[model samples]
Target: MNTFKDDTLGSIFFQVMRLHHIRSHTLMGMQKIHRGQPPILGLLWDKDGRTQKEISEELHLQPATVTVMLQRMEKSGLIERRSDSEDLRISRVYLTDKGKQIKDNVEEAIKRLEDECFDGFTIEEKLLLRRFFIHMRDNLLKVSEYKEI
Candidate 1:
């Protein structure tokens, strides 16, 4: 079996997550969607007409980061931002028809990637892995404030 150069748990975890991120980016790229845009799109999917601030808070992203993503998405015709009628200063984001249409494609791409990732894992193993991940997240949460990517 091939061994990693650094066999420490932290190193191995980083390597695994890095590889996973690359694969996910590739899959999302195939759909012409950047990896960062999916989370925002997901929020808009669940509930349309959300403000930039709402998206930023919900996704744990900085306001500037969300703004950049929204700008790109608007240019791609995936979403549109309009001034809220009641509050002209607030801009509410809404998914365009193209954005609504790409939901299936995005989901399928994610499903395919997940299927490949868990190819050899059994149901019990998958459940155990999920629990481990949750525990790891909890551990991090107990420490200083952690920002998710």
Candidate 2:
């Protein structure tokens, strides 16, 4: 029984918080798109008319992953891909009427999730928390850059 208190407590707390945050947000988004909606709606919520490559970059996912998701979404009739008028090589993604119709529902779900996450915080406290997370993200980006070097 190696009961390392400090390290074990911090590690477990961080992992649990991360898992809960991801699970809550994912569930909220999925529920909003319930009843046969596309899986890509989660990504589309950020930028509706982005190309698959753009979506992949923004979401920090591989282009191939985005391509597969888009294909499935297209088959489900939740989105359509149109050839760029100026560049045939580029394809623009647009939400179908069905997709557009669910935007409000998705937005509401996100709001509800956010509210739940910040349930007891004041508005200023919530803003500060947001800033703290942004700083943490920036620090991670810096660490990644250092790794690349």
CA lDDT of each prediction against the hidden true structure: 0.92, 0.69
* Model 1 Cα lDDT, one tens digit per residue, 84-132: 9999999999999999999999999989999998999999999999999
TM-score of 1: 0.93
Instruction: Please state every model's RMSD to the true fold in angstroms.
Output: 2.6, 5.0
Q: Ten consecutive residues with minimal summed lDDT in candidate 2?
A: 31-40
Using TM-score, give the best candidate's number.
1
lDDT of 1 at 89: 100
Which residue segments of model 1 deviate by more than 4 Å? 1-3, 146-149
TM-scores, one per candidate: 0.93, 0.68
Off by over 4 Å in 2: 1-26, 29-49, 145-149
In model 2, the Cα lDDT at residue 4 comes to: 32
Cα lDDT of model 2 by residue, 17-125, tens digit: 7766675658655754332233457566666767778777666667887787778778867789998888999998988887777777766766776677678999899
Q: What is the lDDT of residue 37 in candidate 2?
A: 36
